[model samples]
Target: MITEDQLTSQEAIALEEKHGAHNYHPLPVVLSRGEGVFVWDVEGKKYYDFLSAYSAVNQGHCHPAIVDAMNKQAQTLTLTSRAFHNDILGRYEAFATDYFKFDKLLPMNTGAEAVETAIKIARKWAYEKKGVKEQDAQIIVCENNFHGRTTTIISFSNDEGARKNFGPYTPGFIKIPYDDPKALERALIENKNVAGFLVEPIQGEAGVYTPSDDFMKQAKAICEKHNVLFIADEIQTGIARTGALLAVCGNCTCEGHCERQETYSRPDILILGKALSGGAYPVSAVLADDEIMNVIQPGQHGSTFGGNPVAGAVAMAALNVVKDENLAQNARKLGELFRAKLNEYIKDSTIVNLVRGRGLLNAIVINDTEDSSTAWDICVALKENGLLAKPTHGNIIRFAPPLVMNEEQLLDCVAIITKTLGDFEK
Candidate 1:
């Protein structure tokens, strides 16, 4: 019976390898603790956390305000199962709907669940409102999009690893090339049953593949033209990760939520998760105006722990941290500096190709084939050099530090990254 304090990193890794499901291929280092933008391995070595748990910790790890809110609510009440209305659920709903400027919200526990919820809502809207024949409502998705791993989500995914044998995959989804508004319009014109056009404003899992600047605006316009819903999955790109409050907000620079600006391409259905709870609890939500959201009636959809009191408290606190700390503005500022510095370093570098992304959610492409291990090796070196990052889509390494990170800390991490990459230069 070894206590947590008595376990070593090797011992912990072995235990997981032996007992846990082999779903994830995590980095070799075993982190024991995290705060702000830094994490500590079991051996007490500290490193900058450049991944920020896939941007789930945008408010930063172990944020006191969010944790305190969770603690206070847990002490009083935790779960009510939606059988009876809890005191805090309404308040959270009101606050969140107001904060994000949505007419209603449907809470869930994970990003996948929220995405699933949005799909269901879209399908229902298609049948009841759009008059698409039942079971024939088709939703449009993009190629190379990483929505989630659920059965329905993977049904439309291009990732062979996730979709291979995961089916007979779910059906009624139309797939098209991403970042192409003309393709989107063609799809809508070809299919009369397009209930919604589901897209990631900036594709995060596809190695941070950012679309053109006007992609969102143009797509929204096309969806409007065809009366199809414009759904934005902001799970990984939301909560100020992309310099804006939501990636769909486009170039708006307001510190907090504001009236829908000309730069903003408001989604008909907004799917959010990750930073919603500040990494303190599992909280995800689907938001829309009443005309769209109201389609979900009693017993049609829900989760027992979806709107639990603790999640409600933690989410409100987390959103406050984003606004009170001015994280959106900070992410915008630091992200510019980070890219400029990295661009300067990669000028004559052969191992690195180019940097691409919006705000802090950026990635650097390793000058190697997708099948090559150079990107993974560079990440391992980065870990050894007191920084942590991971590769995506083979040869691309995503670098998203916590939004709470200060300028000095960001520069320090930048130095560590550049130095580590130098070790892998051809």
Candidate 2:
């Protein structure tokens, strides 16, 4: 193994460019280490992590409690497939189900896997329980949904770049306008074979396009009216990243009592990933009451490393840190402070149009057109000024720092961002 001290930032990026696939157009900052709300470059320059691995490090980067749990579990026991029961799987299932208020949990290894699992479960539930014809059950999805990059998940995506050459797409999905109750109700009313409506509580990959305050609750009501399942893909919004235990909880702050809140519209199917391990392990899960989850029988779906010992320990520890540190409440306070700061700058900025988001999951619309390189350039400048952020398609730059950020650090980041935007003022 080559020591990181011997590698320059340019050398490391060049190596990745030559060896790894060019699937992502990353900003030119090579992060070598992360702790709390900050990360370090190979040359030892520290920078605030504005993106937080696309909200996957909500508990902050490399938290010692989480790392320690993983190390201990790795040394003790790591893997054992479902062929035979493992010691930690049962504990993880019970702990997580209770934590999220679900009846059962099915483990997976990635966000995409968990999404695929939910789709399968929804389809199976449709056929087995809902009296839908086999292989004909349809799931309603939003037009600009960004569940994952898997072939099937991308089938319904409107992005030309992610869909262009990938063909032989999966069928059985109907698209509707996001955040509109009328559109959702119409789809369910028109499609008698619809089984579920999958949605992100807040559309993170779609430039943090948070819908109307009533969109989630309204959608759930519509689904209920049609006996359709309301599935929430919370892979990017869960685990206190969105100022609540779950975004679907609205303004709820009580540990995990989302179902008790008047605004909470509990999902028939809940998918979680990303921060489940605090970015320490590849852990994801699909949760539901027994009635929905029981559709998956033996040999229907399984991942070799899904519910292994290390994942269980890491996830449990990661969740504990979120609760112990009050990351959700912290995110709520910091997000309000961040948006207020940005709004003040945006009023006078020629480089930014507006800012919008809930909690730390926010975005600034560049004053430039969608096709311009201004957002990318601003990001490059931000990196030079001691912060790291990336743009979502076109001119929208998302700002999602780790939930561990304090008011002082948030203010510092807000200053860096506003100054960077000013540098591009027309």
Candidate 3:
């Protein structure tokens, strides 16, 4: 019973409160339009978007190329479903497989779905190909991992809020401390039926926690030695959000590098989403070589809108933007600049304990406990200062802007962040 002309940000929030389930605690900003690295609120106030919709909009709010592809594809053909062929699916499949250097791709619609698909594929491969027993197959996942929110995916989460009432949880997932190769090694060795090691190259939702240097290389080697599939949940870290296309692409000893030797450790199974469609559409994918992917027969798995023509076109344009624009390099350079600026502020401030992250995916730890409202308060202050960011956990605010941001805009944002934190106690 509301008119469009009369709707304000407060009115919109009120409407959502009345009608929608209160699942999220969001900043009090009603954004209505976006382009490149910024969004406009309902009142026409502008702010730099820092979270990028959980790293889904790495190509920025709506890249012209991706939107154009989506629009063009919609006009010509949208969904033919996986039951039949589509003109764009094959071309897109070929493009994506080559881009990621994987032999095959299994498309899906969301990050969680892709993670689920990877789990199913790994379990099947373990039983049929690797000679593991049926229900005893185990997948090793890191602590503080945030894959997605499906029932099965949430089953393995260590976060109390994410897993509290969502059970009886799924089983067969073994947990190990993240960034510790020794823990993963012991888990794999002690458990003879280990089927896969599922990990995030860089933990995103866990306040952008990054792993140790040489951890990925050592873990990959262990998985290979044990004949277990190395499943990387790159839903948040992939597609150039981190420098070099993946967070697992640099050297840990290089001060600010990614530290993962790409040549030494290529994951057997890769799960991707978020930025896969440049935030233009929902597109997720699981990738593996044919030997592993072919284990599932035709009837074993499928989704109706998984590889539709529109998704195919959108994903293609998104991936192309990542490469064509060199967003990976841009993110890396900008990340260094951002961290430097933040760290400079951290030197004198008692409000922030630390700043950690790579590329554009970063987080600042508030000088408060997990139950503190400081992070939320700081985010509100940031909104007032013309920037938008959100807290992950209670005292941890994540700041992952789109890779399309420029240096001047980034510095402007840094100034806003510093000034806001400066005025927190005043």
Candidate 4:
């Protein structure tokens, strides 16, 4: 039994090792508090939080507005288990539907659950509306997808670590290489029973694999050509993380979903999570127009805490903060500066091969191979230099700070990052 007084980072880690599930590999820092763009370790050491908890805290850690909304709602009604009507759920639903420009929204509490919800919706729509034979409908997903760790979601994943022992895997999914529109075209054309083509506008967990510039537009076109539902999993890349309202928002800055923007590739179905609640609470949502969404009848789908009052209030305030603060515009301008700065150093560095990403969601490829520890070692050095980032795969370190960050803090972080990488020069 551990005592409550002055537990060191080491002690906290030890306690976690003793009792917590060993499912995640995390950095050694033990953070106790956080605010915009920075977190304080238990020892009161401050560091730039570059990961933003995998882009979930894009509004910044412990954002005042989100916290206030959550606190205020907690005092009223927390949950009614969907058995009774709550005053806040309708207002939230209307707000979210207008924000995303969808006729309906299906709310869940996590990215994974939202993804599962999308899959079920698409399949049901296929059978009931698209005229595909029951149980024969297949969804086409990109390779290296990190939607969620649910059994059904992982069934389509080729990630051995996430897939190895978790089978007999669920079926009805067809996999294709990401960023290849021709392959997607061929797959859709060849398969008559395809229900949907699910993809990440920017594949986040898979080393931030950004597809070709025309990939989204072309994929949406192909899906339209064949009547396949275009499902975009923006769980990691959405909510201004990629410099736009969504990575699929393309060149639009119209303060809305950008359905009018010709450059935007509006998917038939959209899945969102992460920053939806500004990391204050769990809130995920799937959106579609009436023709597609109305297929799910009353008894077909539901969740206990999915559309609760607290989640409702938290998500509304969180989204309002995104627009009111102009985080999307901030991410776009700073993303350009960040990449340009890193590229300048990368030109002369032997430890880094390249840097690629949109908005603040960027990554640097280490000179070492995927199995090398060079990226891990460099991250440790970064922690010592008063910043925190993590590797996605083995050799790629993702640097996604909260969108609330400004120019000066970003440059300071860049200096810390470049200086740290300089130590690993070969």
Candidate 1 wrongly placed segments (more than 4 Å): 1-5, 255-260
The TM-score of candidate 3 is 0.96
Each candidate: what lDDT? Answer: 0.93, 0.91, 0.88, 0.92
Return the TM-score for each candidate structure: 0.98, 0.98, 0.96, 0.98
Best by lDDT: 1
Where does the lowest 10-residue lDDT sum fall in candidate 4? Answer: 251-260
Which sections of candidate 4 miss by over 4 Å?
1-4
Point out the worst 10-residue segment of candidate 1 by lDDT: 251-260
**Model 4 C-alpha lDDT per residue in residues 1-426, reported as the tens digit of each score:** 223687889999999999999999888999988999999898889999999999999999999999999999999889998889999999999999999888999889999999999999999999988899998999999899889999999999988989998899998999999999999988988899999999998888888878888899999999999999999998999899888898998756657875667769998999999999999999999999999999988878989999999999999999999999999999999999999999999999999998999998999999988899989999999999999999878999999999999999999999999989998998
Worst 10 residues of 3 by lDDT: 250-259
Native RMSD of candidate 2 (Å): 1.4
Q: Could you give the C-alpha RMSD of every candidate to the true structure, in order shown?
A: 1.5, 1.4, 2.9, 1.6
Return the TM-score for candidate 1, rounded to 2 decimals. 0.98
Candidate 1's residue-wise lDDT over 1-426, tens digit each? Answer: 235676788898999999999999999998888999889988888999999999999999999999999999999999989999999999999999999988999999999999999999999999999999999999999999999999999999999989897779888999999999999999998999889999999999999999999999999999999999999999999999989999988877675455557768989999999999988889999999999999989999999999999999999999999999989989999999999999999998999999988889999999999999999999999998999999999999999999999999999988998888888777
The window of 10 residues in a row where model 2 has the poorest summed lDDT is 1-10
